[model samples]
Target: MTKLISQYTALLDKLDRLDWLVPTLARLSFLAVLFFYFWNSATLKIDGSIFSPSAGAFGQIFPKAAEAVLYDVTQLNIFQRLVIFGGTVAEFVLPVLIVIGLMTRVAALAMIGFVMVQTLVDVTGHGVALGSLFDSAQGLIDQRVMWILLFAILVFKGAGPVSLDALLRKRAT
Candidate 1:
């Protein structure tokens, strides 16, 4: 039992020596973005109007123009709701997988798909004219671009050195 404990301790020490900051940061950022997206999705009232009613009411007193981004009322279906729930859950779960370095590619791919669908919805449903080089659609474009880049990095890099995936791969070989 003592020997087994010692071996496990030694293994942990070796793992601690591995540089995990970069991957961990990436995973953490991913989680943060997911949280933001989920919060916005759950809170934002979609009323099929250019200006959100809630925002308009708030704007009257605040004197600041609310970012009343519009979405398609028709697209808000049961399946889409399920997708949003799934994506939110995935956002919460995938980061843990990424931090541990288990099935990193799969988690990254899932996130990528989630972001892509969101981007598509934003483009098609919202009045964001496609391929417009103007600053009018800058915010939407920037958000989508960032997600694309982040997912691409995760896909290409997998989890960093300190992940469980690395250990498993080492064991398999």
Candidate 2:
């Protein structure tokens, strides 16, 4: 136990010294791949639509309300379609902002929101179940929790001394 604890402590110490750009780039790369995967799925129309079945039924039940939300004319199921559309937009926009380190906090926050909602939908609507904390799709989706935590760290750390964000901050001062 003592040996394991020491090993973990040593690892954490190494992490502490890593340049922020390394982690930032890693995070950006991860998000970029995720974006591509989701975008490709959306483009292929792999599913019936992006909208939830419940949402589509709701639209059918309340056409007026659906129309008010601009979901009336949708043929591919409003909820599913909207989800795909929203995801596509986020995939395109957020990664760019994150890669450039512009408004990174805001982008990370938005990403957290997106991942949360999608996870909820997948769990509740699709009947996806998680077997364990580390092996579940839920855990994978909530991996943003880690990213958000990292982003919070970055916000405090100011994107390190070499980032565009840091450069801008330096210039401002």
Candidate 3:
């Protein structure tokens, strides 16, 4: 019994020593989603002109409101347009920072906020159905909650030793 307990403790310690594994995997898994969903969207939102979106980018980003405005998002004020652009940029930038583990804690926190706003837009602006939080993955909110949890973990634990943030910390020490 004593030997079995000792071996179990040793195994738990080994797992603890690899604490970086889950956070790194979370960031990497996020990367797969970003490459397809975000980079593609970002590229679509920008054409040859700097900061200028293709004709339909805004309509896609704010579909419901755009329809209310007869699909002319240009009717939005300068500040509103800038907000859209900023959101688009963040959707691209924040995820990249997280993947590289540079300023990962900040990036993850920002991502949490981003996820919240994105979910809000989906729910309020697009009229997406809200599922009960306790209900099994019934709608977009549940899926987003899972994403936020991943970001929250990084926000608390930070990038692990394999990350750029960790490397910089070591050098600074």
Which candidate has the top score in TM-score?
Answer: 3
lDDT of 1 by residue, 19-106 (tens): 4655656766766765456445533432343222233222221222222323333334455444444544565566567656689888
TM-score of each: 0.53, 0.54, 0.85
Whole-model lDDT per candidate = 0.59, 0.58, 0.78
lDDT of 3 by residue, 129-154 (tens): 76566574566677788788888888
Which sections of candidate 3 miss by over 4 Å?
1-3, 47-50, 54-56, 134-138
lDDT of 2: 0.58
**Pairs of colliding residues, candidate 2:** 50-80, 50-81, 51-79, 51-80, 51-81, 52-80
lDDT of 2 by residue, 50-162 (tens): 43333343343344455567653444455645655566567567756666777666776676676676666555555456444467655764565565565555455444454
What ranges in model 2 sit over 4 Å off? 1-35, 38-73, 76-84, 135-158
| lDDT at position 58, candidate 3 | 67
Q: RMSD per prediction, one decimal? A: 12.1, 7.7, 2.4
In model 1, the worst 10-residue window by lDDT is: 56-65
